[model samples]
Target chain A: MEHFIETIGRNMFAIFGVMALVGGLLMIASKSAIHSVLGFLFAMLNIAGCFLALEAEFLGVAQILVYAGGIVVLFLFVVMLVEVSKKKEGEVFQLQSRYAVAAVAVGAAMFLAVFRKAFFGVASPEALVLRPELAKGLDVAHQNAQAVSRGLFADYLLPFEILSVILLVALVGAVVLAKTERV
Target chain B: MVSLNAVLLISFLLFSIGIAGVLIRRNALIILMCVELMLNAANLNFIAFARHNGSVAGQAFALLVMGFAAAEVAVGLALVVALYRRRDTVQVDDINLLKG
Candidate 1:
């Protein structure tokens, strides 16, 4: 039983690791609009699994449900609706040379700093907080679902409702913006 | 034990590539998709930190980021739809309606 539990944990981690690599590569290499959306979905799946490995099942579920299911579909629908028929001839972007270089340099440096902090700096503790029952091969996902519901109602009530309002506004705004101008 | 750093490093690289695509791609829809990539990269970082910290705050923030991303996508796609209606082209180079 213990061996089974350990194997499951390890397999989950390994899956996330490989998914991250493949998803990243695909997202980078995708030139087509549809391919990029699909790549992002794959990457989201990997990230959600990583959240599970980190013991945040609530986040893992939300990541898959909201990001992969909701956003990617919207992207594909929009891509299909808008046609890019012209040849890729003229410059598509207007990034200033110095600003672009600086942006990349700063982003890279920040990422490295963050990476060091996460893996090697003062914040390099795993701080594993597993419930005893959870470590004993019991399904954490079920418990997490209950806890997530309690958390949402108890502590996260306001933010939860606020998000719904935000979504409503966005839907309305999208309709308004997409409305054609009078002839 | 696979370190969180490894995951974060991959996320950063993905984000950089997305930014590059946004900068280099002339297709507006593709650029929007790249922007989505960038936001997802940030969300991954948030979830990793959430798991490491044994805190729910990271997940909360990630959800907020998701909401913002969704809203951004809506408005952005609407803009794309609007642009396509006005100019009949979705290419960035083709959008010169405002240029003098």
Candidate 2:
């Protein structure tokens, strides 16, 4: 049973990886703003799945809540709220193939350089290693949630508090930017 | 061999393409999508490294990145809307309000 769970987890990680790639491509090729937003949402969802496979359930939930649920919806709302005329849609879809070729070239170079250090010995094994600590929390996923809370409050307390401050600033800035008049 | 590195490589490629598009394109929405793509790429890297290292920190960082990315998109879109209202357009070339 443990081995079975590991195999499922490994396979899920691969699936999430593929999904992320597909979502990225869709985001690039999407002509409409709505489509781009949807593509981004799909990509974020795949990343959340990756977080789950990495045994970071808290992060997965946060990804879903903040990204897929919050940001994409805001993007959709803004797209609808903005009024763009047909003539004003200039250069929105004009993608040059040369740039894409160059991007692919650069990506290939980076992949090749990192492939040796990262994936050479990976062997593509299907074996999953289930940590005993993770299984303790499986019965009730959110009952205690110690790893995340501990990390946030103790180890990462300073960064966490700083992030809250940044969030407040962002909220105020957003409101000011969106307001009709200068204040 | 379809290893974790392969997965990371693919994600990186997609992400770089997204970045290149954002840098080269003039469309604001597409640029925002590209930014999202870059964040996703980093997220993929975090997860891949987490799995390889057997640590949850990478995944936690990815989550944090996602939060910031979402907030960034919200602020970016709102700014875009405000820009549209002021200039009646969304082209990158036209945002020269303070070119003094």
Candidate 3:
């Protein structure tokens, strides 16, 4: 039974990880802004799934709440407000296709170089194993949210407080920038 | 269990796709979405490493990154909206007022 569960979990991770990568690619390839937003939504949800697969349930839920709920909505609102449908369809991509090709090639080369050295060559398989101490806190019996909150309020209190201030500044900035001046 | 390498590879692929989108897309909104994708990729890395190392710090950092990403998107979209109003289009190529 345990082995069966492990297999299912591994498969879930593979599926969601591929979904995220493909969704990101679709976002890039789509011409319509709406389509790109949809793709971005798909990618964000799958990344949340990947987070769950990694056993970080709190972060996974936060991913859905913050990203899928908040960020994607913001993107959609801007898309609607901007009148992107009015732009000429052919103008979706910049004229310099050559630069895109070069950029993709460079990105692919970087991936291959790192993959070859890290996974296939020097890094041992043991490196992939979860450390026993970390795994102990994350076991299925423990409350992930409680653990996360404990960490946030105790060890990470300063950053937590600063994040709230940063969020406030961003809120003010957005309002100032998006608000139209009244005559 | 899924290997850490597999998870990291997925993140890398998403990040690379994001880079391509930022380079190729003309619309500022799409570019911003692509940047979000890249940020999510980094968040995935942080989570995966956190799991592998058996530490909560990775998850904490990921949460922090998420907060920062939210702030960034809010400001970024506001800037995009302001730019569109000023220039009448979101195409990056045409908005060359700041070009040096």
For each candidate, what is the lDDT?
0.72, 0.68, 0.82
lDDT of 2: 0.68
Per-residue CA lDDT of candidate 3, range B15-47, in tens?
A: 888887888788889999989999999999988
Taking the tens digit of each residue's C-alpha lDDT, what string does model 1 give over A1-183? 999998877667557856865775676466666776788788778878877776667778887888788878887887777645644435534556668868888888987887776663333455333445433553433566554444445567788788889889989999999987774
Top candidate on TM-score is 3
Query: DockQ for model 3?
Result: 0.60
Interface RMSD of each: 3.6, 4.0, 3.5
Per-model TM-score (chain A alone): 0.69, 0.73, 0.78
lDDT string for model 2 (A1-183, tens) is 999997866588677867877787777676676777787788879878866765567667777888777877787777776644435455655456677767677767876777766673544332222246544544323432465454445455676676677777778888888788756
The lDDT leader among the candidates is 3
TM-score of each: 0.76, 0.78, 0.87
Q: Best to worst by DockQ, what's the order?
A: 3, 1, 2
C-alpha lDDT (0 to 100) for residue B10 of candidate 1: 64
Pairs of residues at least 3 apart in sequence or in different chains that clash in candidate 3: A134-B54
lDDT of 2 at A70: 80
Docking class of 3: medium
- Candidate that would win on DockQ: 3
Clashing pairs in 2: none
